[model samples]
Target: MMDIVKNKTETSNSVWHVEHATLAEWQAVMAWAKDEGWDMGLGDANAFFEVDDQGFFIGYLGKEPVAAMSIVNYSSSFSFLGHYLVSPTYRGQGYGLKLCQSAFAHGGDRCMGLDGMPAQVDNYAKWGFAGGRNNLRMVGQVQQDYHCPDYIELVQAADIDDIVAYDKSCTGIDRSALLKHWFIGETRYGFICRTGQEVTGIVGVRQSQDGYRVGPLFANTPDLVEPLFVAALSAVPQGRQVTLDVPEKADPTLIKLAEKHGFESIFHTLRMYRGEPPKEQEHKVWCIASLELG
Candidate 1:
């Protein structure tokens, strides 16, 4: 669906090699992602590699990079597939399938999840992905007049451990590495709502190629969602484009809240699983991290 062969001119004959990409070589895939309108975060290259260094795979036609895919094994029971792409020069030659199989083989028998474009849903089904749910990418410059609750505070260094633990409790997946990358100064910002030392909720927003993206919005109770969301959006300058990837199965109130704040559905990705899906606390999550990494 990304039009892999959109403007390419390539020789008909070719051979491809698939292998893990080092942190430096991974930058090439990021470049291609930018070319394809992925809108990934600036520090994603380093942060994603930390999840599983050997998880990022690249397929090369001789010495030139042609395709890339990432299957990050966050835990032995869970792996997430993302960044699937093929160069414009190499479509119609089965190279994408080759790269996909290579990435999938790395997951072995673990449940693999991915958020894919609608055009590829059937192909993914044939490859064993099913149970698709739409994850809407909501965009808007939300305006909030309410003052931040005293319980809500900017994420501090000391809050990292609790935030990581809280995320695991809510999502049933340990993505501490990616969460850690959220407070890396300028690129990302985070806020946590606490009640007498108890973490009530947390949200993170990061700069992206397209706009500021708010994700992984989790709460202990539904009451905590709005404050955390308001706090995160407050970090972005007024009128800047902001995005939130909200799963179709999230709490109904969260959907209404997003809609009430002037946010509109720009597009959506289909969240599918290749095996047993994660048993996350859906009601507590307002948005997921980017589809490419979630």
Candidate 2:
């Protein structure tokens, strides 16, 4: 509701206008995303809405939704851009660019992050998103034979602080609210590895539209990964495919483990930032939390 598409990017500035999203509109947009093979998590819209109610938006062409996007500000200096979608019937009409510009404005001076698909890299770059790194999407049936290490335990509600700090160390984003809510649903399974009383690692998997996704897989060393991976895999419903978005350059072990467990290569996205990049503890981040949120 801040402003309409009057920035001159649109062919018909009067026709298309972006407004803050309602939860119902967000749900409808998420459904479109699922049908388009994006495999959105079932509760993603609700979680995202709770994180920043004003972050999501819809582009309306005379009351009909034609585009959608989110610019969730996690803190004073960090924001994430995602779920940018334009209706096929509305694409090529400049609605996407208009919507994107709105997101850019909403994010303001925050250092923004996005996992841009191949098709959108140039578009994102046009707006100054730079320092692209690949986030590989690996899929297959990983081994379930590994036992949970004696030091590992299911993530309890009281463990949120440790998990949030651990997650921030690797990603450089203080996503405490999102991380806490991530484990609330029944489809979510998370675990933490410990050394004595100290938390050393964390991993979680959640069911998406198509399958389960393993993410925020952070650890101090390679020795702690597989056992947690196996523990996460145990929580998914039977017969569902497994996916791990690998930051190959950041952590080489993920790809090797994926291959060892029969995972095959899929597509990848470029992790790009629109301002000064974050000082992430990349070596510890085996997989990221989400493309849409990171």
Q: Highest TM-score among the candidates is held by which one?
A: 2
Q: For residues 158-214, what per-residue lDDT tens digits would candidate 2 score against the true structure?
A: 888988887877877778878877865678878898887778899988888888888
- Candidate 2: worst 10 consecutive residues by lDDT? 4-13
Runs in model 1 lying further than 4 Å from the true structure: 1-14, 142-147
Candidate with maximal lDDT: 1
How much is 21 displaced in model 1, in angstroms?
1.3
**In candidate 1, which residue pairs clash?**
4-88
Runs of candidate 2 with Cα error greater than 4 angstroms are 1-14, 142-147
